[model samples]
Each structure stands twice: as structure tokens, then as C-alpha cells.
Target: MALAFDEYGRPFIILKEQERKSRLRGLDAQKANIAAGRAVARILRTSLGPKGMDKMLQSPDGDVIISTFSFFLSFSLANDGATILEQMDVDNQIAKLMVELSRSQDYEIGDGTTGVVVMAGSLLEQAEKLLERGIHPLRVAEGYEVASRIAFDHLEKISQKFEFGPDNIEPLVQTCMTTLSSKIVNRCKRALAEIAVKAVLAVADLERKDVNLDLIKVEGKVGGKLEDTELIYGIAVDKDMSHPQMPKRIEDAKIAILTCPFEPPKPKTKHKVDIDTVEKFQTLREQERKYFDDMVQKCKDVGATLVICQWGFDDEANHLLMHRNLPAVRWVGGVELELIAIATGGRIVPRFQELSPEKLGKAGIVREKSFGTTKDRMLYIEQCANSRAVTIFIRGGNKMMIEETKRSLHDALCVARNLIRNNSIVYGGGSAEISCSVAVEAAADRHPGVEQYAIRSFAEALDAIPLALAENSGLPPIDTLTAVKAQQIKENNPFCGIDCNDVGTNDMKEQNVFETLIGKQQQILLATQVVKMILKIDDVISPSEY
Candidate 1:
């Protein structure tokens, strides 16, 4: 703050976010905040629908990434909302709120990251007009809260129940395909959607209707074609035998999951050892050999055919284990080790004394598969004792394709899991938004206050989604939305949406476009919450950098 005097020599203070010259207050502050938020929202607006463009994001370190994306916020071929926000290097506080807005949608819903931001941005744009007309920001925020509730309730009213069972999974596959259609791997959406549905079902508990996504692993590799992607009923570790001479395959393997290294334990604190005398050196070497022998003996005495260690193997101990005819894989990560344990129904043996037959994990067959001319080998443990833990091993010609496929599959998998949890769904391609817009607009007449203006603006903001969808799909935005809106009214159909794919119909239900009910509700609620908070911030203050 800096002191200033009026013409009457009265003193007052000026508050600025940065330098003294950049003073902001009241309407100006709200406008600045709204603009900041809209800037972030505008970045994601183009990436809204299935025909949305991908963003190519490049980092300062020269890494190019095109990831899970949409709403046209391409950082690097990415249309995913959460990815673009997380990768964005924005300094604006309100813009950062937009990032958080995207993150909340991703965290709860796992999809529609781009759509959420676009929705929030449109809300802010509408609020800006209300503020310009002298409507209070608080009144605008309250109006939005009401509009959001109306939209949310209308979503539930229009949402349809999707049926699926172990024997009936086609509906789930169709829903997942809708998510994948907007992704970079749309051509293979059918196959990927089937794989995603199967993977979710394999890990999902039908009785509880809850899926522990941790039980499912999505492992990607740069090889073969995208069609080569398949679901494994067991764990697949990107590792091979410690030694080439070791057996490459084992049948009916009794596996040992170990945390301890092959070498003798070292002191936790710093220490030194002296071996000036040859006899002392020989004694020390003998002691080390004895330790290695005991560790190997403990593993073998327990009837373990395969060893997967959390730590790397010692060269001497590795040679000893190979010679002793025990196949071992070393340097496994902790999470992967746990997944392996879950997959094989094995206990992790942290010490040699813990080695027992009951502690072992059983697998029908464990084999090493090599890919590419580079001899990149991965260990495949198939037909496990516990068939619940599975992996979707993805193969693609390039890393970017694999990464994008991973994003696409992730969206599909989340949609499948969501359906299992709450089978209620709404039609996609902006059908839900259009329906909500109509509902909220109809409800606006019920209120007789200045907030009605803001409420009407909220209704208009809801149209931004269908507008973005139609615009991205190369259709005349206003004309297409107007036509669809007319159809929805004439037919009394809530499922009429933009024909983004030009599938010859504006009816998303007939087109089989699906989105989770809870997910759509979440998008509107989160966007409104963020926009309201942004509007309430009529001032931005930061410590002056020295």
C-alpha cells in the first residue's frame, strides 16, 4: 500500500497486487478476476467434444506430450482437461483456480476435465455481463447456485439406467466406446472399449458394485500395433531373469516375494572395515559367502521355484543363486511387488526366517517375452492363483500413441467402473447440457428479483457447451444448436444433441453416446462452485517481491 492525498489534502491508501500503479477495486477487481478465469476457460473451450482438436504441449526440458485431453486445450496433442491444467505454467491466481477446478472434476469424475473448465469459463463470462449491469457479485453467485441445482436435478431426470451383468457386457462396452470416440485412438475404440470393460469387470466386485482400480494395472510398451493390446488374467512385470543362463520359463511356479537383498545386511549407520591381513580378508569373504548360502538355502528349503526381490541382487549372490538353480528377478518396485503378491496370492517374505511354503505365491506359468530388436524383455506371469488382479498390456508403434491410448483407455475404464458403481447415465454430445439449459431457462421465470437476470444469464451460459460442441465439429454453432433445441422441444426428447460425428442424427440416445449421470452432475456443480468463488474474489493481494 502507498499513501495518497486527495485535492482536499485528505489522506487515503492505495492497495495493489503488484506495483503501486496497478490498483484494483470493486467492479474493476471482479472484472479482472473474471477475465483471468475466462482466459483459462477459453484455453479449454475448443477441446469440448468428440471432434475436438488435440493440444501439443512441450516442456522447457524439450519433452513433448499429447495426453488425455479434450476441450481443445492442446499442450501436446492432449484434449484431456486435467492434463492440460496440470501441465499449464500459469501465474494468475484466478487462472490457478481454474486449474484446481479441472483437478476436482478429474479427481471425482475421472473424465470431462475439459468440459468442466469450459462450463466454468462460460459461467464467468455470463457473470461478467451481470456485474457490468450493476448486479451484485454475491447476488450473481447465489443465482448461479440455484441454476446449478436446477441443472443437476434435470440431469437426473433425463439420465437413463444402463443394465449390465457378467453375462451382459455389451452396454458397458458401448458406453466406454463413447468416451474413447473423442480420443486420439478413436479408430480402435471398439477393441479398446471391450478391453477396458473386461479389465474393470475382472477387478470389480459384483456384490458390492465397487471396483478397486489398484487391482488393475495398465502397462504400456512401444511395440506391435495398437490392436495387440490385450488383458492379462495375471501380473506382467517389465523385468526378466537376473541371468541369461537362468531358466526363461517355469511351470506351476511357487514364487517368493522378497524385500531383503541377496547380500549380507550392512550396518544402518556409517562404519568402516579393515582387512589389512590376508587371513582377515579370507575370513570376511567366508562370512559373506555363508550369509549368501543361508539366504539361498532359506529360499530353496521353503520350496520356492521363483524369487522376485524388492532390491537389486549382489553380483556374487546372483551368481550363487543361478548356480543353485533358483530363478530370481531383482530390482522390482514396491507397488509392482504388492501387485504381484496380490496377483499370485503370495506373502512378501521380508527376511530369510519368514520363508515358508504357505508364504509362497503360486502361478500356473511364468515366462519371459522379448519385444523389438532391442531385446526388451518383460516377465509374464499368467494363470495366477488369484485371477482377480489383471493387466492391460498396451502395444503401440510410438510412445505418443501409447501415451494417448493410455489416456483414452483410462477415460473408458473410469466410465466402466462408474457404471458398475452407479449405472445411471446421460446421453453425450452436448445433449445433457442442452436439456439442462432448457430446464434452467424455464425455471428462471419462477424467480422475481434482480437475481433473475443472473439466473437467465446462467441459463445462457449452459448453452456454451452445445455451442462449443457444434463449433468444434465443424457445424454452424448457432444454427446447429437452434435446430437441436427445436427438435428437443418438438419431440419432447431430452437426448437430442449435436451430431459431432455427423452420424445423420441429432439424437444421442439413438447414436449410443453415453456419459455417467454422476459425472455430468459433478461437472456442473464443480464448475459453478469454482465460478462463484472467483466472482466473490473482488480483490487480489500479493506480497511485493523484493
Candidate 2:
């Protein structure tokens, strides 16, 4: 009370107190959120490739559930712990950022969600050191940015040209295996590559003015005899209906193809269907009917007898085709389609007619002329497509194992597809567009120039693989990042998908610039964000300290 202070001094004291409290609260919440995020990441780190293990979670209600690495990450982040952090008045922005980071990290590495968390944890520890050393957050962030640039440069230097021709695909496959633990990668790569090639061939055949199943042959021995001719034609895109007892043999059929899932449309709302909506629905139904009719016609034109659509037809559509005397079966998903295609000799498309019990026992149909070893079929498939094949198989002894296997398979497929279709430009997982704000932010982080901004703009391009895998693998949006990374390591071999001899050629250089530039941008943005996040954590402290 005896001390007198100037007006400026009084204002300074008040501002200092407010700032100190704000920092304290922010730091406390940030630490908690970061810890939770790191923990979630750690749980799924080992579940990266097809060879990655499964995880089991038991609910409080005595329910035992099993899931893959990606699923686990999603579950953990969306679990009660994350909710508690939010409830504790954790900064929503930071919490949400961590959640997204977790998702992105999981998607980027497939099995490295845990690794990312650990990395983040390490970063946090390092940040603490920086703080102790009295390093300002700004300086730390700047240093990290420099370090990230170096890391990205290293990644680029290490990146080999992605090749896809038959001559060097094995080495490419081996490269993917370098960081993985599963033998399924080679098996799946061969199988899927073969399937894609066969599918392409089948489509090419159908597109031919002359549709002929006679041109296709069943190759291989099952139960000791030469395989019978059961031609599978196009991609089965449908599901089978759950109905009255169909033939046991039909039900027992190991491989059938349909154009759509068999599940009926969900019940509609009680509100009366509008005439316009009804008309549109009716038009779609008519189009579907015509499509099937044309498909049957094509089958007849091609002299195909056993046909399956990966997609499903309506009851009327099914009846119409069945009445037309075409032997057919339908499968619900692409997984089932692949199984059917493999059973039918590599043909992704099914021929006309339902498969008889006797025919089902024989190799259902042969998509390609190759047989025996999976490698041979894969080679044949690749040759047919003029592209390369890479498969990632997940093997486990339990349900968790199977789930993880499927997730790995889906990721590998996406990587391979991107390499083949888009020349290996890294796109967002699931077609998510990078927001304009994010792009701007990313550009600003680079040199303050338009060229750098344009170069960084590619970061906004959405990658469809992760999203597709997440949707297909049953993981939520939160877990996609982990799954993506796992898959990337398993499938990313620049030299794997490209023709090695063609390297340094003008054509190669052009393709390289186009492909690698986008990849570089993606790498840059990811690295930058990671470093920025680390810097932001410098001020964080344990809640217990408060």
C-alpha cells in the first residue's frame, strides 16, 4: 500500500497477469491433448503392413471386438479419452488439430500412427529441452522449418523413379517388403496385378466387335484334372439377395460375381415420394434394366455362359435376365469379385449363365492363360496390362488378423493404382480437396513468392487412396492417416512401378518432374506442419504442474 506506481506501470502489471494465466491454461490443455494424441498413435504403430498384427479391444459391456491397426487408431481417438480432454476445456482448435494430425499420420503410413505419436512425444520432449534452454517458440519453429526442408530434400534424393514394367517389378515388390513383415505382399501383388490385367483383357475382348468366350481358356489343375471352361467376364459390381433357399450348391458357390451389393435399399421416409424423385428413380431403374439387358446381349454375342455382375440388379432386372436363360450369380463387393475372378481364371467379368454345381467344382473360369505359381499369373497379368503389379497380403491367426490384412490389401491397391493411373503424384486420401486456407498457409510457409506458392499449391490436391481404403476397410475418418502410411511404405518403391532402363530418358524426365514435384510438395507440407506443431508444444506443461 505504501508503494506508488505510475499509470503505465499499473497497466503493465494487469496485462502481465492476464498473459501469464492465459499461457498457463493453454499450456496445460495442450500438453494433455498432445499426450492423448501420442498415446492413440502408439497403439497402432506396429500394425502397418499385411504382415502387421491385429488388435483386440474389450468393451465394458463384456463385448469382445477385434480390429486392424487403422481401426484401432480411429477408435482410440474417438473414444472416451478424447471426449474427456474436450470436456476438460482443452482448446478445441488444438484438440481438433491433434485429431486431424492423428488421422493424417495414420493414413500416410498405414501402420505408423503409433510411430507418429511416439515421434510427436519425442518432439514434445525435445520441445521441453528447448524451453529449458530458454529457446523462444519462434526460433524453435524456424529451426524446425530448416530441418524439415533438409529432411524433405533427403526423401527426394532417396526417391527412385517408379517403374512398372515386368522386368523389374520383383525388385520393386522386394523394396516394399523392406519395411514390412508379411509374405502376403508378394502374393497379393501378384494376385491383384493378375486380376487387373485379366480384367483389362476381358474388357478389351468385350469391346471388340466380336464378343467371344472361345478365345478365353481355363488354365490350371484342381483335384488332379485340367480346369474346365467357366468364363468370368466383367467386374461383378453387385450383391446377392438374401432370399428363399436357393440351391445348396449355388449357396455354396465359393466365387460368384454381381454388379452391386445384395442388400436391399434402406427403407424410405414415410413422406410421399415426389413425382420428380419417383420419375428419376424410375429412370434409373429403367437404365439399370437396359444395362443388364445389354450385358446379357453382350454375353450371348460373346457366347459366354457363366456370368456374374459385381454390382446387383433389381428384382425385376434379375428376373428379366434369368428368364432370358442366362446362367448368372452376383457378388456384393470388390473383394468377392476378386475371389470370383481368381476362381474363374483371372477374368474380372463373368460370362452369361448361372454356374452349375459341377462347373463350380472345376476352376470357375480362367481370366488369363497363365497358371500354377502366383508369380507366373502376376507376370501374365502385368504383361496383359502393360503395367506392373504389387500386392500386400495380411496374415493373422484371428479375426483381428483378417481385418488388418484387408486394410493392408486395400492400401497397397490404392498406391499401385495411383502409380499406374496418375504417374505417382501423391493425392489426398479419399478425394478430399485441400482447403484454400490450408494451401495459402502452406504457401506462406515456403519462400514468400508466387512460384513457391504455386509449387506448394499441389499440397491441396486430395489423395483418394486413403479415403477409399478407409471406406472399404471400415475405419472412421480419424484413423485413415495411420492406415495410409502403413500402406505407403509397403507399396512405395519409385523403381517398382517404372521401367528402369527408361530412367533418365526424356520421357522419363518429363514424367519424373510431373510426378515427383507433387510428391515433393506433399512431403514439404507434411514436414512443415509436423515441425510447426512441435514448436507450438514448446510452451506446454503437464496439468499436474498447474
Candidate 3:
């Protein structure tokens, strides 16, 4: 230890063992941070576009996730940007930032998670060159901010409004198909996209153009092929009747949604109850049976044909319920209960006193549907009074496929929702990026300062996306991008992008590949912001984490 004096002349003690700590400042710090972030972005780069690769990550628990993600969820097939980053266990703070960048994009835009991280990594790579050329890091960041604005504005100019209504849903379905094309479920992208779009529209309010995703439950079962996936007009739950002898179908049913328990309420605190004689025991048993009977009688009194309970009951109560002609489904999850209430326009009763005829939910038909075996059965609630709540019942060969399909459909659903909120759209296949790159590069000449160089670098970074797409698709990255850029300028057509699928034309419009305008703009703005943050970090200190 050593003593030191501050500016005020006060003495202080200093401890040794500084060897465990490390610090990087200025150029060294910036380079290290850039390298960490760039490494992460590079991992997701190949996962971009339709031909992009999927990442298969294994968790510590040995659960393998394969995502073409584009890995918020660990499935068998995926390489999605967000999914990969979320599953990747990283120590570097900058790398974690890149992960957050992807997550935020997924949360907000629901698509382009990989592309944003890839773009950020490209920008960082370019900024590293600028730093070596003696340009100020902040100056490079400022240039990026300027370039991002230009790209954002350019996206708006190139975007077109897509009109769709109840009578016209093909456009929305096509937009969602573009999203699913790069997913593991792309084999059935058309069917999945239709299901996604219809599910969104069912839960959406066209007048307000707003949708509450909660109302649309995504239900999946591992059994049939992906083609068996269907959208239900009502809620479908993985539950069956509480009893075997209970009728499987209830027509024009009156459902009593209950949160209260079926058995008599137990004491909250510890208590002693000793039976000294057989008569006392008999009286106590009779009292308990009375409680169960009263609860059942209350439902019958309220004219409830079906009872859906949030909590489970004992076999005694189940037997009594079945004998009393009340078909009760016990242990229904809270979410399914709320959906049931909404679908049937019923109220959830917490107490027997609150039970009334008006509180009962009305449904045209409630049936127990069995799949391959009677053991594999689900309760299908349909033709409700409200009927606004819906479910996308997905079936797959295995658990992994079902999980991967959920993530893919999630993106598709979000895309359809975004369009409903705002009908503006842009072409995909990296065409939009190429268009913005040409615009940003041309605008760079208008700047007179060193920011001009940074601006031009930003334009070059923009080419990384189309390049990556072309490369992943087995085409020459530079050649494909060059031809597309040339075509955009020659034909004055901004819709030209990398034809990853080798579909005759390079025009995304002709390919019918559509992406939301807000999503693309958000991607550019987010990538630039993250890169700028990384460039401005001139100091990184790691304290001994013991």
C-alpha cells in the first residue's frame, strides 16, 4: 500500500494487486470494442436475406436451437440475428450491446434483426479504417448520424403505400410471405403467411388499424405435418373434460368461468381439529359434503351448463359435478380463462355469491376434439357470442419444428400488424439498402468537411447487406450488387435488389417481395445509433470481478 495526496492536499491510501484489473483508453479501447462488436455482427451476417444460413446453438441443458432467425427461442432450426445473439454467451460489453441492438429491433420492428446487426458491424469495420486514417471517432459518429438521416429520408421516398382491406388481403399475405421466406418454415410459407395475416386481421380493428396480439393465441401441437396448421375463429386449448363420463359436446352452452376453488376453503393459518368419536367424524364429513354440494347447486342455479375452473378440485368434487350433470374443466390457465371470457362475453366469478345468469359465457358449441388418440385431445370452443378471440393451431412432426414455426409465425404476424397500423411498404432482397447506399454516397459529395469521408464510408457499409445476401445465395457478392446498383441508376428503378432466389428478374416489385417501410427505416436508424455509440467509447475498464 502507498499514501497519496489529492489536489486538496489530503492523504489517501492506495492498495496493490492492480494486475487483476485491465483498462483500455483512446485508440486501443475503440479498436477492441469495434472488434468485439464486429465479430458478433459477422456471425449473423450470413444469416441475412432469403438464402441466409441458420444457426444451431446448444444450451448448457443440451437443448439445441436451430434458427434461420434470423434465437429468442431455442428451436432446432434457426440463425435469426436476435436468436443467435440471445443464445450466445458473450463477456464483452460491446458484444452484448450488439445483442441488445438486435433484440430491440425484434421488439420494435419484429423483422430485420439480423440485417441491423450486420449493418452495425459493417459501419464499425469502416469506422476502424477512418480511425487509422487519423479521423476523430466522434467525427465519424457525427457523419454516421447524418448518413442515417439521409438513408431514413431516402427510404420514405422509395416506399409505396400498399392498399388492403377485408375484401383485399392478398397484399398483406404477400408481405408476410416475404418475412417467412427466410425462415425454416419457408417450405409452407404460403399457408403460414395466410394463417398469420388472417389471425392478425381477425384480432385487428381495421377502423383504428390497431391489433392486440394477446387476443390471438398461437397454439401448437406435435403430431401432423405443417400443412395441418389452421387458424381457428375461436379459442383452442390443450385441455379436455374433467371427467370421462361427462358429455364430450355441449351445444348452446353456458360456461361459468371461475377463479375460486371447487373444494371448501381451507384455513389460512394452522389449526387443530380432533375427532373424539365416530358421530363427530360423520358430522364433519357431512359438513364438507354440504359445501361441495352447495357450490355445484349454485352453478346449476345460475343455469351454467359448463364450468371452467382456474384451480383444480378433488376427485370427490369431480364425481359430484359429473353426477350432478355439470361438465367442469378444472385447472384452466389464467390466459385461456381470459380468452374464454372475452370470446363468450362472460364475467369471471371469484365467489359463489357473485354467480349469476348474466356472468355465464355463451357459446354455440363446445366440443372435445381428439387427434391421433383419445389421449391427444383438445377443447375446441367455437361460435361464441363475441367470437373476437382466435387461435392459430399449428401442428408439426416434432417439438422442434413446432417451436421454430412459432417464431417464424410470430414475425409474420408482426409484419401483418405493422402494415395494418401503417400501409407503407418497401421492396426486400437488399434492394432497399442498395437504393439508400447510392443516395447516401451521392449526398457525401455535397459535404465539404472530413465528415464527407465518413459519409462515404457509411455508403460502403450499406453495400454489406446486399453483398452478404448475394454471397450466401452462391452468387458473386460484388458482381450482383454492382449489377443491381447499375440497374437502379440506369432504369431509375429503386426496386431492384439481389435476386437471392434466382427468380428471373432483379426487381423486388416483380418478385412481390415486400417489407414494411417503418421497419427498414428503423433498422437504418438503429444500426447507425449503435455504431455511433461504439465509436464514441474511448475508454473501457474491467475491474477485478472477484
What lDDT does the true structure give each of the candidates? 0.87, 0.37, 0.90
Residue 47 miss distance in model 3 (angstroms): 1.3
TM-score of 1: 0.92
lDDT of 1: 0.87
**Each candidate's root-mean-square deviation in Å?**
3.6, 16.4, 2.4
Q: Give residue 525's error in model 2 in angstroms.
A: 4.8
For model 2, residues 1-546, the per-residue Cα lDDT tens digits are: 124458676522323344456554444544554455444434433342223345565445545554332233223212111222222233544445555555564354322232233334434444444545555555555654544454444444434455544344432233223212232323344443343334223432222222222233222222211112122342222223222222212221223344433333444666664556777998877876676677567555654444555655566656765677555555345664454454344344343343323333223222322234532321111111111112222223434334433443333333333333323332122211222212233444656433333233223222222222343344453355444333334554222211112233212223222222233335345534763674566354435433
Q: Compose the digit string of candidate 1's lDDT tens values, residues 133-249.
A: 888999999999999999989998998896798889988998898888877888999999999999899889989999998898999998899999999999999999998889999
Candidate closer to the true structure by lDDT (higher is better), 1 or 3: 3
Ranking by TM-score: 3, 1, 2
Ranking by lDDT: 3, 1, 2
Whichever of 2 and 3 has more TM-score, that candidate is 3
Model 2 spans with C-alpha error above 4 angstroms: 1-23, 26-56, 65-96, 105-114, 162-164, 182-324, 328-401, 415-528, 537-546
Q: Write down the worst ten-residue block by lDDT for model 2.
A: 379-388
Judging by TM-score against the true structure, name the best candidate. Answer: 3
- lDDT for model 2 comes to 0.37
